[model samples]
Target: MQFCDECGSMMKADGDRMVCTNEACAASSERDSDLEDQFVTTESQSDDDVIESTEDANFEGKPKSTDVVCDECGTQEAWYTLKQTASADEPPTRFFKCTECGHRWREYN
Candidate 1:
């Protein structure tokens, strides 16, 4: 909302001074503190704000394998899980649960 006093054209803020847009009357002047087109500012937000949280996903599904046979029920399919029961250089131990009789067994590696 600032106007060039010399050219009577619109004035734009450029750093600390205001420049006229008119090509014929290229006038430049210092910025006014009580000008209409002063730098815009916003108020700081309050600290009291609501925070949101999310629930953990359900990771309870067990993987099934047809290769692992159940000893108690003689089933061909069973759910197996691996655990690091030995040293870091060795392989992990596999725990198997029968799908038919719900029998559990562990195999060390």
Candidate 2:
């Protein structure tokens, strides 16, 4: 990632150029091709992969009772956990799995 020359903040890609994310600075520059090659991209997980990973992380081994209503099977019982998905100041996201149909969903507080 390139740093903004004006504000010294990390610049983000905007089409063929890099733009400063800081609203106060709002500076933009051409994106270097060599730097683009060094940019890291996160590998997306498939549905099966995500499900397998979640199942493997079932520390309690049993579904916990929750008041969340499942969208798939309209079940009222679910297993829930808090996952940190954003910055430290932001609230942890809630992930839920329906006990009846195994449907998964996320709720942001």
Candidate 3:
């Protein structure tokens, strides 16, 4: 969080010292060991942190099942969604994901 005194630019940690980010000024200073210790990096996430899984995480979104065959695995079932990708006058795009192989494809309407 330290700034260069010469050119008023942010200083970054360079080994055991702090160096100015500005190439023109190129100011360097000794970093305080105590301050460095206080600013030491720590893990942000813990084992106790619980993360909820999204429906898309496992391709579990409500499937608009169709007879479309998968090009990768020849699977007949898939999850489909319509997305508005074009202008107002144009139709929405159809996106499909194969349930068995997770292969995705898009069709413009």
Index of the highest-lDDT prediction: 2
Please provide TM-scores, in order, for all candidate models, with all chains considered together.
Answer: 0.43, 0.44, 0.44
Off by over 4 Å in 2: 1-65
Task: Report the lDDT tens digits of candidate 1 across residue range 10-90.
Answer: 877677788888988989998877763455422234523322111221212567778877878789987776767789999
- Backbone clash pairs for candidate 3 read none
| Count of residue pairs whose backbone atoms collide, per candidate | 0, 0, 0
The regions of model 3 sitting more than 4 angstroms off are: 1-58
lDDT of predicted model 3: 0.73
What CA RMSD would you report for each candidate? Answer: 22.6, 8.5, 9.9
Per residue, candidate 2 scores C-alpha lDDT tens digits across 1-109 of 5789999998887778889989989999888887766885333324432322265455244447667899999989888777678999999887787777777788899
The better-scoring model by lDDT among 1 and 3 is 3
Q: State the RMSD for candidate 3.
A: 9.9
Per-model CA lDDT versus the true structure: 0.68, 0.73, 0.73
Worst 10 residues of 2 by lDDT: 44-53
Measured with C-alpha atoms, the lDDT of residue 49 in candidate 1 is: 34
